[model samples]
Target: MAKMVDQNPLKFSKYIKTYYGISFVEFLNRLKIHYFLTHVDHVDQFTLETYIYQSGFANRSTFYVAFKKYVGVNPSFYLKELKGK
Candidate 1:
């Protein structure tokens, strides 16, 4: 796909880092978190741990770190805020 797009993997990664101000892995995690949040109601189990795993995070700590970086709060806080709305 990178070759099809006329970019090497290294060059495409550098472009994303430059444009988005974060590493490619961080950007992908943010996207994963966003997707999980927006599409979470489809899941049967609604635990935060479940959500973290579904969001493509390997562990709670990493999920929380990425979620906080992208959303400016912890997932619990985000859920609370969502509930209030």
Candidate 2:
């Protein structure tokens, strides 16, 4: 089995901010929403986790912290809002 490489979420976030003119957390929120919309067939947690992992979040705890900071709510709640939109 191949070992998975660990990603540095903060570094990746910095890059996003440097190039995108948006805060890292904002970029992450947008990514989460985009992922949900693109893969609407998936359940909320699945989409959120997939985006969190794919976007170089160090782990679930970090993802949750950053997500809450940017989104003003938890990932689940954010997903619920998206559904209502």
Candidate 3:
């Protein structure tokens, strides 16, 4: 991304922090979470584990941690709530 925009990597990271109020990794995780939420249901299987990998999460632990951190609930609980509605 820095190379694409002609920015230094450190400079780009700082810019992301200053502008978005989060580090680049957090920003990326948020993007992946959003993608998962929006696109997971579109998958034919509809399995959370499958979606977890598809969402660019490295593994279940990482996915659970980031999902809870950003979404304020674990994916299973969140999805259960969505189903209840």
Best candidate, lDDT-wise?
3
What TM-score, computed on C-alpha atoms, does each candidate reach? 0.77, 0.45, 0.87
Q: Which stretches of candidate 1 lie over 4 Å from their true place?
A: 1-6, 41-44
lDDT of 2 at 24: 64
Using alpha carbons, what is the TM-score of model 2? Answer: 0.45
Q: Who is ahead in TM-score, 1 or 2?
A: 1
Clashes of each: 0, 0, 0
Q: How many residue pairs in model 2 have overlapping backbones? A: 0
Off by more than 4 A, model 2: 1-47
lDDT values of the candidates? 0.82, 0.65, 0.88
Q: Rank the candidates by lDDT, best first.
A: 3, 1, 2
Under the 3 Å rule for N, CA and C atoms, how many clashes does model 1 have?
0
C-alpha lDDT of residue 68 in model 1: 90
lDDT of 1 at 42: 48
lDDT of 3 by residue, 1-85 (tens): 8999999999999999999999999998999899898985565477778888889988999889889999999887887788777
Q: Between prediction 2 and prediction 3, which has the larger lDDT?
A: 3
Model 1 TM-score (2 dp): 0.77
Report the Cα lDDT for candidate 2. Answer: 0.65
Quality of model 3 by C-alpha lDDT: 0.88
lDDT of 1 by residue, 4-69 (tens): 789999999999899999988988998988887786564445777877787788999998888898
